[model samples]
Target: MNLKVAMTRSSSPANGLLFALTSAGLYGFNIVYARIASFTGASGSAIVVYRVLLMLVLVGLVAAILRSSLAMEREERGKLLLVGVSSALQGIGYLSSVAFIPVTVAAVVFYTYPIIIVLVSPFVEKTPLTQALVAIVAVATLGVCLVVGPAFSDLDWRGLALAFGASIATAVQFFAAARCTRTGVVAKVFWIQLIILPTAILVSLATGQLAPPSILALAPFAVTMTIAGYVGGFVLQFLALGRISAVAAGILYCAEPVVAAVSSALILNETLAPLQIAGGALVLAAIVANVLLEQRRRLKDAALVPIAD
Candidate 1:
């Protein structure tokens, strides 16, 4: 099916929200697995390489089953290539940072996407920042700081820097994706993973951490789950983004760390202090508030338009 058909089939507000939440849950679970693999002595680059390689195979099977040919126009191929390279860079930077820092710290730093989106909005959308959005942004920033503050002294500065850098790369990838979708979704994803496969492999090998998985080892299973989660999460993201506005989608994505923290506590037995819990609550509230306001505005516009028409 075409992208438009897929999106239209699930474009209701309720469906969009569910799809976005599903994406976040899958991504959160993936993060938990990645952290587990990392703690078990799998190098970050190695984990990424394994997951990307597996995802390539899995996604290929999915494409074949769907009878979808993975192809893009010559002009679009360049953008897809850039997206792939950016995806790899984001992965490398994130993994490298996690090697030095706590998973939560790295996660918080990478979750700075909302701020980046807000900063980039004027240039891309030619829209002025409203006061309410600015206030919510401040709340979100404070929440991030609170969440990471207790662990600040223990954080690896280099890791923090790399993690922040990765956030920038990811933000660019997201913005670029909004433009790239004009061509095709699966094609873009296929091309991005194509580049990711080699980039991840090269980084893994260069780090001297590219040991093939042992038959007796559990890391392979973890990597397999990670890749599965990534593919599902990404496809859901494509679906959600196509139906919702970028700002709304970005705000919803900002809630990912909360989901991550909860999953970390449950899966990894990680603890969050009271302050951290409160901070996470604030972050959730900020996202909820944004969505509520947007919904209200849409409703108001709809109610007024019928009388005028």
Candidate 2:
């Protein structure tokens, strides 16, 4: 191929879907990887520390390569750094939960962030609280309940609480990310990940948790897969965003939970029961519906605006 052709991205929508779906799969695999780390004797806190350090290194390299600057106005930059707090919580909560529950279950619950965002956007983003959104939240909530099953007593409550708490933090993360448009994405990612350093270290000290992985956790295969899943996933996510609308990306990202379930089954020998599978499908459907619903409302609002001419 010529240089220009090689330099240009594929304009085909399918290409974007491929990138988005692959990223989703990588993210899905990350859940199982965290579980593996925990099973190999790494604390949840330690997993975050290790992963955060890796991300900081990778993202920092990318930022340096592109000569990206973090010189944005204080407010916008502050918003970006604030995203790290929720991100750390998101990582810590879900990773911690996987130690006590199946990765599939932790993922299923954690994926409810969009649903939580829908429930709170009215107060946060001033988005209208429409009936469709309410119904979407209800359906997704029911799906989570079914996935968790009625026997709540038997399951570890700590995992459920942590996973759900992560979901809430993820919702808040989305809001912070939305308001942080001034900084370049790469720069923001690096800085945000760097912000996780002090917080993660502080968490390690506060909880008296180890910050290093075991020998098994750092094995060639384990380290390779975890790094690929997170760092690679982060790269492909941006590639997908560059190629497709955020709305399309959001819809395709419903693949994340599906990926988590399948990968856990294949690699980790963990499978969801029939009812739980059905529940996951319901949750996915609601998430897609929510994305579509929001897009339609935005379009309608745009049409209502009178032309300046």
Candidate 3:
């Protein structure tokens, strides 16, 4: 029985990594889906409004069906609400960036969130910074620069700014979520969608960007985004965070841009410059190195813990 229990414990983190990778793939598809919706005349804010509304209804209904309590302590509610606001900002900023820049560039910029998290870890996560981690982050940053640097001169400044904003907002959202008290994944996501829905609605209305698409255009994409992106991607992401360290999850999420770039090339007829290709390779290498180093560190730490007989 003890051996069985130990095996279960050892398997969970691996499962969490699998969940994170699955979420990253779905998120990559979400980028493609968003671009398709944009081609079909859906504005960024309009897409956010639609997607958040759909997620709210779906998650809420599932929670109700499960008889899950949506209640949280007042302090936890406030933190989760802040996380929701950040998520909304990330959605708007990232989608708007894609509106003005190539998907690859926008994705690379948005991926800076992992670096941001690492940089701020000492303050927010209270984790010690090691030279090795810093070096890995630097390589990732260099990789991103290589990928997007050439296009930087041609892209709109507004798009760059929005992408950067999205990166910061995403970093904050993840950190905040990590700090929050334990809550059901569905309930947490439901509350986040609840906060995002009204904000998205107001933004779409205020900006006069709320033009509804044809049912033919809206139906397929809406269902796809709601199921694959929100339910499959983000719900799994939250679940993974419960099992793995936030830093591990963030590093794994670096897979997203690579997936997006490949998907864009295949689906959207996008091509990367040779330099960009090299940069992407570097980014993938850095993410792999980070993951391996983190695993090693975890093993070392575990070895140091005294086993009780």
Best by TM-score: 3
* Full-model lDDT, candidate 2: 0.68
TM-score of each: 0.84, 0.74, 0.86
Q: What is the C-alpha lDDT of each candidate?
A: 0.71, 0.68, 0.75
Name the better of 1 and 2 by TM-score: 1
Clashes (N, CA, C under 3 Å) per candidate = 0, 0, 0
Alpha carbon lDDT of residue 144, candidate 1?
62
Worst 10 residues of 1 by lDDT: 300-309
lDDT of 1 by residue, 1-309 (tens): 555654444336546566776887788788777767666676556666666666677768878889777878776677676667777888888878977998667877887877888778888767577888877877876776666543665766899899998988877776666556555566666777778888877886788878775521557666666767888888787666655555556767766666667788888798888887888888778877777766675566445543321
Model 3, runs deviating above 4 Å? 1-11, 73-75, 97-108, 147-150, 154-158, 213-227
Q: Which digits, one per residue and each the tens of the lDDT, describe model 3 over residues 1-309?
A: 355665565566767777887898888777777667666566667666666767777877887799887776567887898889998899889877877887657777887888888888888878888888878777777776676543545888888899999999998887778766477787788888888888788778877887674432654754466346756888888777666666767777877766667777888888877876887798788777876886686667656655544
lDDT of 2 at 288: 68
* C-alpha RMSD (angstroms) for model 1: 4.1
Better of 1 and 3 by TM-score: 3
Residue 153 lDDT (model 3): 52
